[model samples]
Target: MTAALLAGVLAGYGIAIPVGAVGTYLVSLTARTTLRTGVCAALGVATADGLYALAATLGGPALAAALRPVLGPLRWVCVLVLLALAAWGAAGAVRRYRHHRLATHAGAAPVSPARAYLALLGITLLNPTTVIYFAALVLGSQTGDAAGSGERVVFVAAAFAASASWQVLLAGGGALLGRMLTGHRGRLVTALVASGVMTALALRMAVAPV
Candidate 1:
């Protein structure tokens, strides 16, 4: 049980710590929207991670083998989605900068909490790395006496809880940062810089060797 708990915690952080496209978007989303929305989005991402972890544990090696063949293509698709998001964020930042008054208007129409959650959930799911990480945990698992159904349940719940806590902390941090940097120039700089970073990361993913 202890090993399974430790494995689940490590697995959660291993997948969450990257702060890749999804993480970038989460920060930006919080900056533009409210903490409530950001929290929902964070939970959405955690939910997806938890689901993938459970799938990996149950499906075992067969599922991993099946996913191996399509990992390359899936990575490309994830890259495309990220690039599109980066483009939209860039455009929004530029527009806000050009029309200072529009910041109020743009921020006024923030996404609802539910919609934000669904959006993040979908985005996280698109990243095949989540499953890959979970699959690795499954492959090397030494749960031993802890491999019972109850232990598996505990593992999944623990992973989800751990992931949700960390993600929520991120969202809170982003919200606090957004408040501190609410100045006109500060907002513009942060938004544009984040967009650029995301675009570069997406391009790197696109060209990366499988």
Candidate 2:
């Protein structure tokens, strides 16, 4: 059980520590919104991670085999989705900046906590790499037969907890960033930089060897 717990924690951090396009967006979104909303969004990401971990634990080799064939296509889909999000974020930020300058007071629509949660969840779910990571870990660890049900539960819970902690820390950093950059130009620059980073990461994903 202890070994399983440790492995799960490692796996969780292994997947979550990489600040990819999703993480970039999460931080930028938090900078634009409230901490409460960011927390919800962060949890949404952890929830998706937990779900993938669970699937890996339960399905093991079969799941990995099934996903292997479609990984290329799924990766393409993820890249496209991320690119679209980057475009949307950049465009929205420009529009908001223009309106702010014009004193029209028209800003981007606020994302409620619930909607933010769902949106982040969907975005994370679309990343097939996450599932592949978990599946590989599960298969490599060979914990399915030896760990038993209780240990598996602990493993899943631990993975979720680890991911949640890391994501929340990211959100906290974003909140601090938002506090530091309260001006219109600062916000616009931050948004554009984040959009550019996300776009670059998405492109990298497209060209990366599968």
Each candidate structure's TM-score, on Cα atoms with residue i matched to residue i, is 0.92, 0.94
Give candidate 1's whole-model lDDT: 0.80
Query: What value does the lDDT take at residue 41 in candidate 1?
Result: 97
Give residue 195's error in model 2 in angstroms.
Answer: 0.5
lDDT of 2 by residue, 20-117 (tens): 88899889988888899899999999999999878877887788788888889888988998899889878877887877752212353588889989
Q: What is the C-alpha RMSD of each candidate to the true structure, in Å?
A: 2.2, 2.1
The most accurate candidate by TM-score is 2
True-structure lDDT of candidate 2: 0.84
Q: Which whole-number lDDT from 0 to 100 does residue 95 have in model 2? A: 82
Clashes of 2: 0
Encode model 1's per-residue lDDT on 45-153: one tens digit a residue: 9999998878766777776778788888888888888888888877777777777843523545668899999999988887867756765766677432337887777
